[model samples]
Target chain A: MRIWHGLLIALGLGVAGGLYITAPAPLDAGFASDHTADTEAGALVFAAAGCASCHTAPDGASEGPQVLAGGHAFASDFGTFYAPNISPDPASGIGAWDLPTFARAVTKGVSPDGAHYYPAFPYASYQNMTDADVADLFAYMQTLPASAQPNQPHDVGFPFNIRRGLGLWKVAFMPDGYVTPAPDDPVLARGRYLAEGLAHCAECHTPRNAVGALLTDQWMAGAPNPSGKGRVPNITPAALDWSESDLIEYFTSGFTPDYDSAGGEMVEVIENLSQLPEADRAALAAYVAALPPIPSP
Target chain B: MKRIFGLSLATCALAAAAFAGSHANPALEGAVKARNAQMSVIAYHTGLLGGMAKGDVPYDAATAVAAAENLASAAAMKRAVLWIEGTEQGAVAGSRAKAEIWSDAAGFEEKAVALEAASSAMITAAGTDLDALRAAMADVGGSCGACHKAYRGPKN
Candidate 1:
């Protein structure tokens, strides 16, 4: 009877230990307090991040960027995940969320309720963002019109549906900072921030392991789109045989050198990119043009 | 008058036979080849104009105007017979046109009308100024996309 009692206590202790280990830690209070919100910079960050591409309703009838009512269904191997409403509606959106909660959600993939987020949110790439950018994005999002739309529940099944399991996946894949070292040049460094931090281009462009973690070693060599429709073309310097000017023009006009217009998911990305200043586009082109050429996979 | 009428009828019969034979096989194949060739020419002219717009090549007014004229003429050409019913997708190996084009005939015609309007506007704007050309570029690209999104397959 004593041995049975000891076993029960041990099992309870093990469960408690597991919960403690998986719990999400919010960002440092000092970081949130010190950061100031800038709406203008945030707007640029918002465009760079392509927030509307996923956050907007997938009905194909939603017009303009103002409505982020969020019912876009991202069907993946795990299951279909719907983007949650991030509009300023107090009851249905993130209006009640303080900057720290927003920051933690964007960067750490943690919810205000201390639950883990599915990586479909791309927080792994967003984790590289500076605290200032995240704050600015939060501020900018607040300026958009609010909607009263309720959040749609995701359709994940079985063990994959268990959100707690994602905490382990996060530990294995999420990096604490930039995936690669920042370049010495200020321009290239800013390009890295835009590309890796907010734009998260590598999320779509890089191939992934069987479990869907990005294969960082072959970064930006291109991969089959996660949505399983078509192959995303290789954009690494090795495979992209275009002049720097051609690259800039493609971003500005969506026309390839061969006269093929940008199609599929790229059309939306180019639309967002078109909103950016010419200088920002040029910076991106310069940075991509300078990447070490990787052979197409 | 009887001999003349008989000769005229014989000539009509021979012409109809030739037309039927062509429409049955080789002419249909010729149409697939001709339409593909015509599309290539359109792409070539557009590429030149696009190159100038991007400043990849020097924007010579003469070259720009010429390329724009070619594109406009190509877009306005009467090539309906080239896209006849039997030449889509599985009927021909290289044709990337989807079968929906036949079912959505009205939508396809609307897209063609849009391309014509855009191409006409492009001709008027092409050599006027860089700004005009840029504005026309968007319309031209948009019109192309409107059709391609619905009718064309992914490039291999």
Candidate 2:
């Protein structure tokens, strides 16, 4: 009995040691040391990235969306995850966060205190954001009106709630690189960057496994809406019959070839896209049109 | 014949009576089919004007004018039978129409009025210039969107 107790204790220690070793690893703090924060360019990046879509308060003060107090509720199969206040409030939001800390959180899903953010934050796709874009976004975010709204705790359950285990999940699933193949066309390249890295379009357009890791093999083939109310449509060439021009116009006006208007959550998405330059919309449409055909999932 | 049809109140009532004659769960289901067909007709003309506005379908003055005229007439349609109570989203399978259409009938009528005004403005201007058609398109689209936001749920 003494020998067995010793073995069990030893096994427990090994497991504990492994967990500690694999704790959500952030990129070196020095990675963000060089990019000069440009608030003007950052504003454009913010629009394309759609930070407000996930972070805005449901019924915030009259000051409006610029006050991103971050109480947006996102419901998923795992549980409900509320968007944290990202306003510039010194204590409630990330107001005190250094550029390095902000970069790691946005790009690596590792919080300043080293806890892993649930994948609902979409770091898998965000992990591809260029260093400069992330840095600029951080600077621009700091300019938003500060809100004292404290961050809400996510309602995820036991096994899923264990943040440390997410370190392993990241290792298994976090895309260390861009998933969309690089296109030679410069316009398409810009579109690819916006769609894959900043917009995180695949987060909804691509299906995921039981554990919620994106099924990268079925990129843009459409998936169930995280809210589970309706299915997201397939946009790959195999399913989308829209011509390149049709796509450009759709992005610009939210009008389908058949004249049906965009509905549901996509209305918000179109609002963001509409604020962007027509050239940017054109580029995004071009990239999406050129994507390799994949059958609907 | 004017390709631009504005299904007036009388015409819609007549169409409703015609559909009322059939019985696949009469009244309610017939109302659903009637409204659905009405929407289809509206969408068809919108598409022709939309295609011209987008430059995908080459713009011809006559075709654009006719499409815009059809849109004006369709937008003017007042089919009360199409929205009789109990035809909302949950009441029928594949119905994207929402309860707010009835709950907030005044607001719904305001949107219908907006659509009529927008499409009426388009008929003459659609054949004027590509830019004019585009401007009219924006108005028409806005009117359509305002109603859909309240009355149309996501695709069912």
Candidate 3:
């Protein structure tokens, strides 16, 4: 018995030593001469994501708050999840994360600590991003002034706190690889990337199951929010009220003839799209209007 | 207590009528400036009331009544401004303020009158019954939408 106990202790010590030695050190990837051009392009990608609206708290004002300061409340049928501070502060934010860890988190819904994050973070959409775009986003984040704001713990109840279960869930739901639009279909592909990944339209528009997973078979079908507002309408081709050009104009200017104008949550979407290059908006509209409608049951 | 509140509101309504009748001002430009400012406040109050109606926040019936009254009074005042020389040009920054407001002057007047009428109906509805309040609310939203469709910019 004494010999067995001694062996166990020796084995534990060896394992600990191996882990300590093999663990990566914090990232020190320096930005040298060539990275400058990439950084400028990265800035546009950052704007495309509209990262500022969620990160910044609206403290009783008309416009959204400062980028990366982190105080927006996202309300859903499940519960409200506050946005976290993503600024480059070493102690309170993503400053310590290495490039590989950031890429995994953004693309695979995994965190720096090797834990899976909730899809509420829109990793499903972001999973479609190209590696180079992901790299640029990281570079842009590095350029941001470090904010030392600590993250608030999520207000989820009971089993929701068991984040480890996300590992299994991710394996079932998340795609293993990033998507690339077909080379011959540039316009449609660009629209798909922007709508599925960056804009995250399905998060609000798609019907959800009891576990809060999206009902992919009914993607973009209209669904009601907890606030009891009008249901988010289907944008599929079967929505007979809208023409292709009408859809394009609505995205560009936020006016819908029957509904009057986009308000509440959609107002932010319009504001984001309004700032994009006109051609990008046109492409998005064209692709969306061309989608094969899930025929009425 | 309710009697005194009713009397005070009646007195204010009559005073608004007096103000509406006296069209004299610092001339066309000044009239337009004052009307635009007044209309902005009206629009802001509508937002506040709509927020309450949706229960996104808290509100009181008395406050709602007061807001509705002020908006009604402002809508009534627009006729004078519309008739004033170039007060027509002042509608632009208030966004969706159409140039056609001056050209189709009679149509614009009709919409403004409809809004004032809806506001008064809403105030009366709030004073008496919940059923009436619901009907009046629909009217108010419709009148705003109708006017916005015609004169306001598509960006609303």
Candidate 4:
């Protein structure tokens, strides 16, 4: 009985120690600290990342610059995660956060309060962003019109609602560096960075496991839409045989080889892609063309 | 009595769908045929413009002007015969139209008006220069997406 008590105490200590190590830690400022903000270049990052796709208020002003007021609901197997107000509003948005806080949240999934953000934010992919790009993006986002729209509380339930538990999830699932190998070709390398990091094509295109970690083995093979309505089409070289030019054209105009126009959420995706330079679209196509083909599931 | 009335109305719809499928009812199918023709005309002109926009075909002023004018004419076509009660996605074979076209008539008309507006703008832009044509193509694509996202269903 004394031995059993000793064993139980040891087990408890180990569990506590484990939790301590996995606690959310904000990233070191590193290169981001010395970098100067270039708001102009940040616009390129904003368009490539489709920051407006999930951040912009669907009902907000649409004509000129879109208001990134952030009430968009992202429904998932875990729960519906409403986007927080990211506008430059001092009170309601990220206006109070400095470049370091924004960088930590964007790249490390750690909040300003040092709490773990739910992976729904896609920092898993964003974690690969260059320090320069993060600084630039932060500078650009600060210039957008601010809205007083309050952030919506997420509808996550039960175990998922325990935000602290996500600390362990992150320790286990957070990948190191780019998921795909760095390529020698400069164009393919740019394509890989844009596709895997800023664009987060994997968030939708790559299937996830039961716990919502991306199935890296089946990269870009596509998956069931989180909405449960339809399948997101596979774009792996195995399934998508579109020429690089064809892919670029589709990105530019939303027209398929079949002459059918894009639909659903992809309409906005194409719109965002259309805003990019033609070279960027060409790079994305080149990156996709280089992916190891995974047969569609 | 309400259930009986609903059942008979459903039966009447099924009959219309059968004709829509087989083209036996010329009156109803004629409307479908006319709608399909207009869409084909739109597609043809769009392809012509797309080729020039992509530089697959050299951008000639006359061809660009003609294509844009044809697109505007097609967009402004009177189609009182199209979009009757029965020919929707699940109701008729090969029909990708959604029930929203009838359920929200004003929204449908708004999309048609938007298409006309877009094509009209395309006319002025198309013959100006390649850059202008490229700029116009984006809006035309957006207008197509706007309606399809609301009123079109997936392929069979």
Q: Could you say which candidate leads in DockQ? A: 4
What's the TM-score of every candidate structure?
Answer: 0.82, 0.81, 0.58, 0.88
True contacts kept of each: 0.30, 0.43, 0.00, 0.45
Q: Which lDDT tens digits does candidate 3 get at residues B5-113?
A: 6566546544544554655323443545676676576666565555454344465678777877886787677354244433333332333356677678687788778
**How far is A53's C-alpha from truth in model 1 (Å)?**
1.4
On a 0 to 100 scale, what is the lDDT of residue A239 in model 1?
Answer: 91
Please give, for residues A1-297, the per-residue lDDT of candidate 4 as tens digits.
999999999999989877796787856656477888899889888888888888999777557876789999988999999988889998889999988899999988888889889998989989889999999999999989989999999999898998887888887777776889989999999899889998889989999898888888999898999988788888999999987866876788887765568888788788888888888888999999888999998
Error of 4 at A241 (Å): 1.4
- Rank candidates by TM-score, best first: 4, 1, 2, 3
Candidate 3 local lDDT, A1-297, one digit each (tens): 999999999999977765554333332244222343376666656666666657754552334433485767776665677888888888877899877778777777777775667777878777777667778888888887777877877777767666766655565565443233343578887887777777777777777777777677766766666455556767776663566555554564454533244555565566567567767777778667766686422
- For every prediction, compared with the true complex, DockQ reads 0.33, 0.39, 0.03, 0.46
Off by over 4 Å in 4: A29-31, B1-33, B84-87, B102-107
| Model 1 interface CAPRI class | acceptable
Model 3 chain A is weakest, by summed lDDT over 10 consecutive residues, at A24-33
- Name the better of 2 and 4 by DockQ: 4
How well is each residue in A181-215 modelled by candidate 2, as lDDT tens digits? 78888999989888888888898899999999989
* lDDT values, one for every candidate: 0.79, 0.81, 0.63, 0.84
Candidate 4's residue-wise lDDT over B1-156, tens digit each? 967865765566567666557555554555667777888898889888888887789998889999999999998997444666676777555578899998997988988898899899999899899999988887888888878888998764
The iRMS of the candidates, in order, is: 1.9, 1.9, 13.7, 1.5
Measured over all alpha carbons after superposition, the RMSD of each candidate to the real structure, in angstroms, is 6.6, 5.8, 16.8, 4.8
lDDT of 1 by residue, A135-199 (tens): 89999999998989899999988887878878777777766677767799887887788778787
- Which regions of candidate 1 fall more than 4 Å away from where they truly are? A1-17, A28-40, A62-66, B1-35, B76-91, B99-121, B131-139, B142-147
Candidate 2: Cα lDDT at B106: 91
